[model samples]
Target: VSSIIVPITNVMNDQYCYQTSKKIRQVFDYKRRNGQYIGSNPPFGYVKDAKDRHHLVIDPDAAEIVRLIFSLLLKGTSKRGISFYLNEHGIPSPSVYKLEKGMTVSNKPDGNTLWSGRMIHTILTNPMYTGDLVQGRFRVKSYKVHQIETVPEEEWVRVADTHEAIIDKATFEKVQELLLRDTRTSPQGRTVHLFSGFLKCADCGRAVTRCSGKNNVYYACATYKSRSRNACTMHSISHARLEAAVLYAIRQQVHLAVSYSEVIAQINSAPIKKNQSFRLDDTIHAKERELAKVTRYKQSLYQDWKDGEITQQEYRDMKATYDRQINEVSDVLARLTAERAELANGVDKEHPALVAFKKYQNIDALSRELLIELVDHIKVYENGNISVKFKFADQLRRIAEYIDVNTAESPAWAV
Candidate 1:
């Protein structure tokens, strides 16, 4: 009788614990789906809102540190270099800072706990700094086991715009892109080269490797320099020459952008300007009507041949012509439809490219930050020439077309 009573009580306690754990998990899942901050502490750059623990607000000092880390990365500084700089500057690591702030926390580190490269990497990779709530990254193994395990990324809960952002989305995205590049720092230098991971051979399509000469540095096709010269030619351009060319290109683009902006401003400010959408609508309607006429003509061919109104050969010939016309009109209609939709979705006045160019109007020198923000990549030809595919190319093209269509004179890009 004693054994039976003891076993029954133990089973009852286990069942009760399972029920409580299941209920708790359900509540937490609900909160996570609703973009609530479920962690013991908010991420380093943010503090839990005093009025609402689920909401995160930027902690000024820590947020500044986070911004600095991103800025340094964009400027081609390695994570290790950034860590060393922070430590040399006597800035506290996140753990030590939180502890110093007297925040309720666990596993507090000592004052001497220095920032690590891994710490900088973590902060740079975190999407939460862009104002998104990213939770459920880790989970207990089970209701009863209580062992922690990393949840797969796909299973992580992500909700956007839950709080104010420490980093803008574009800059954050650019940092992520740069992280994926071959950003190897120079052996003697603390930062990466301005064109690191961006130059590619136009002929062989291989990356260009940097080479040091007696008096200057040059970049040549990786295949030509190291692998096999037979596979590619030496698309070499000296560092100074490349730098000068790139700077000149950037300056030209910046000037063009400024001119385009003024044109856009004048167009927008004009009292008697044409309605862009209305023009697009009219074009689309004309194309639609032409398509309908051709389609009707195509459908009439079959009836004409069957009713003996025309010979089979003539009917076939007419049908083929109509089909060609129909296809041509369809292609035009599709393009016009897309253009109309774009006009319907109004253009962004402060487009990211426009804003970036506006911010860096006088480009006397090229910095890593400038290159990363403006240019996508440089294609190095064998003849010591380069073609730079700038970022925001599509947006720039659209703006150019807008200017050409609206303005009475030729647009900047047209020239």
Candidate 2:
């Protein structure tokens, strides 16, 4: 009797424990999906709102540090460099800062705490800084096991626009792009070169490696210079000449962007041409009528066959013809309707390319920030020539096309 009672009590205690854990997880998941802040502490840049513990509000001092981290990364500073900069400036690491704020944290320091490259990397990569609530990054393996495991990114709960953002979306996206690239830093340098990961060899399609000559810094094809010479030729170009050419190209683009902006403004101000939309509407109406007539003809074929006015084979052939015509007319109507909607929408003056280029209109020198913002990559030819593929290339082309179509004649500059 005693043995049976003890076993029954043990089983009941385990069942209660499992049920409690399951209920807790369900509650947390519900909060996370609803964009509530479930974490004990907000991320480094923000603090829990006084009125609502589930909401986050920016903490000015910490938010400034967060912005500095992003700004330094954009300026080509390496993660290690940023960490060193913060430590040298006597700024506290996230854990240290939290301790100073009298907040309880699990990872308390045993001795002097210092910032690290990994910490900087984490801060830079966190999308929470961009005003989104992302939770469930890690979860317990099971109620019984109690082992933590990383959750796949797709499985993580994300809710956008839950709080004020420390970093804007575009800048955050740009940082993510840069992180994926192989932007190596120069030896004994704290920051990457202006074209660290941007230069590519036009011949072999390999990265262009930077070299130091007796007096000048130059870049050569990585395949030719480091790997077998038989693989590719030296597409070497001096840094000064390349920089000058790139600066000139950027200025040309800025000039073009200003011109495009003015043309777009003029186009926007002028009343939209009703004739274009009217023509599209008329074509759509005609197609709709054609579809209706074909559908009616298809419906009449069955009656004609029943009345013996047409043979079964003749009715089948006629029905197939009408079906084809109906499909064709329906497709035409869809296309015409889309065109009419586009005509009504008109050209956007604040197109990203126009706005981005206009921001750097007075550019005189090239910086890593500017290059990352405007240029996608620079292809170096064996003939000492470089081709820069700028960002928003497609948008620029669309803007030019829009101007050409709307204006009486193509502007001489545009041509």
Best by TM-score: 2
Summed backbone clashes in each candidate are 0, 0
What would the per-residue lDDT of candidate 1 be over residues 278-322, giving only the tens digit for each residue? Answer: 455667788888888888888888998999999999998998899
**Residue-wise lDDT of candidate 2 within 352-372, one digit each (tens)?**
888898898777888999998
Error of 2 at 350 (Å): 3.6
Q: Rate the local accuracy (lDDT) of all candidates.
A: 0.85, 0.87
| Model 2 spans > 4 angstroms off | 1-20, 271-344, 408-415
Positional deviation of residue 322's Cα in model 2 after best superposition, in angstroms:
25
Residue 77's lDDT within candidate 2 is: 96
Model 2: lDDT of residue 150: 96
Query: Which ranges in model 1 have alpha carbons more than 4 Å from their true place?
Result: 1-23, 108-112, 141-154, 275-338, 344-351, 408-415
The RMSD of every model to the true structure, in order and in angstroms, is 8.2, 8.0
Clashes of 1: 0
